[model samples]
Target: MDEARDYIRAMGGGLLIGLPLLFTQEVWQHAVLLPAWKILLLLGLAAIVVIGYNAINGFRADATIGEVVVDSVEAMGIGTIVAFVALLALGRIDGGSSVRDIVGHVALESIPIAFGASLSRAQLSGAGDDEGREEDRRGGQTKSESEAGRLGPFQRLLVAAGGALLFALNVAPTEEPVFIGVGASPVMLLGVMALSLVVTLALVFFAEFGGRRHVSQGILDRPIPETIAAYVISLLVAWTLLWSFGRVDGASVVAITGMVVSLGLVASLGAAVGRLLVASGGEREDG
Candidate 1:
């Protein structure tokens, strides 16, 4: 019974995150135009991300890699079902649509939704406090507060990647990045990058956004190097997402850089939030 309720909550979260995209004309258009290979790649990438997220922040107690993988697959299934139903109800997909079109559109739409489902325990449940205490006990930590600073670099990077991908997924299919790129000068783009870095630093290091508990002491004490590394990762994620959505194809080098910069700002914010989430054992909001 509890398991069923949890799955229901996860589905609800999936709908909350995915319904808007189901109705988006741009999303539909992208589904139609994006090549099959790209769609396949996106699905595979989403599975990997879901698995990484589950391994770090999922619901199972002392979950092994195999358990995490199973949970990730289940989350993907929930996301796909939610996306398909929403698309069908909204009249965005019809019986007339080809199998490839239906599959592509649903697959792309499911990535973020699946992510939200995978994150439902953290975002929608009140059990995080209990889980944290349990973890502290298992780790032989006498102080509950000190447990937050122990996450390794690899875990932090995975969280950052998850956050970057979640944020970039929404914007990658839109024209906003390209529009901003067209209007902004090189100096303006540089300013944007600087702002992204500053915001990321503030959120992860200075902001009291419930993440201080999980923050690494090394990062909290000397944050510059880690912040720079995370910012670079965010840019790489943004660029990859843009490419996956066909946003960078045929664009000039300068234009591609601008689009990446524009998108990187948002992706960096997501990365900051992700770092905190991972640190907090995935108890924070998805952002």
Candidate 2:
């Protein structure tokens, strides 16, 4: 049936087109694809990127299902590749770095890691794009606040670090976070904040450039939306890097890392639910 064919295209777009490109690093990391530990970790990271891309496309539910998948795959793939290229460009890791080293450094060892930087931009950008589309769909939504692509390094760090810290401390309200209430010194917290700032900015720049290339080539559904998705994908993919290095400073940093890990779990769960709804023919409110 034509409908079945369409679904095939959608799955194909995401699985075939996106997976290979997004996991070139993974392929290099595990050419053998043996032992569960070897391929599973990297593949898992790639899976998150795939789902993150879908979430971005989910914002544009009016688009055809197959079309959305294709766009999502393209966006995610661009994000994964460019984040690495950014690492190299930034000289944090050389192209010559072993696959494991590059994966460890870029995805898990870096300060904010690629995920926080990319996701912060994506969230801001998604909010704008969603707001814009909602306005056009409703024909009554405000245009004053729907501007897209305005996320910057400082803002991303604030969102990721502040959000992570706030979420973490909120989970277990203790004297630690509340010390700020007493105007306590924040030397350690400030360091984590600074590290997050540096990591997030680098990811944003490279990922954005790669996403833009797809937009220019007419490979994506839309520039703004795809860019947002790419950013989210970058965030999810970079989780490994964030976790690997996050605890080097001790308790406070580890706590913040735990918060981010928790948040990633929540975000991933939401993505799965969204996919299920879409498969069930649920129309998105914004779209």
lDDT string, candidate 1, 1-287, tens digits: 98998899889888777766776788899898999998889888888788877776543346677778878888999999888988888877899989988998889889888988887754556345556566554455332233334556766777788898888777878899999986899999999999998988888877856545333366523567778888898999989888988888899999999999999998898899888665653323211
> What's the lDDT of the predicted structure labeled candidate 2?
0.36
In terms of lDDT, model 1 sits at 0.78
The parts of candidate 1 lying over 4 Å away from their true place are: 58-60, 126-148, 211-221, 281-287
How many clashes in each structure? Answer: 1, 7
lDDT of 2 at 106: 40
lDDT of 2 by residue, 190-265 (tens): 5533444344333332333222212133333333433344335333422433333232124464454443433333
Give candidate 2 regions above 4 Å deviation: 1-46, 49-53, 56-60, 106-287
Q: What's model 2's TM-score?
A: 0.32
**Minimal lDDT window, size 10, model 1:** 141-150
**What clash pairs does model 2 have?**
107-240, 107-241, 108-240, 108-241, 108-242, 109-241, 115-235
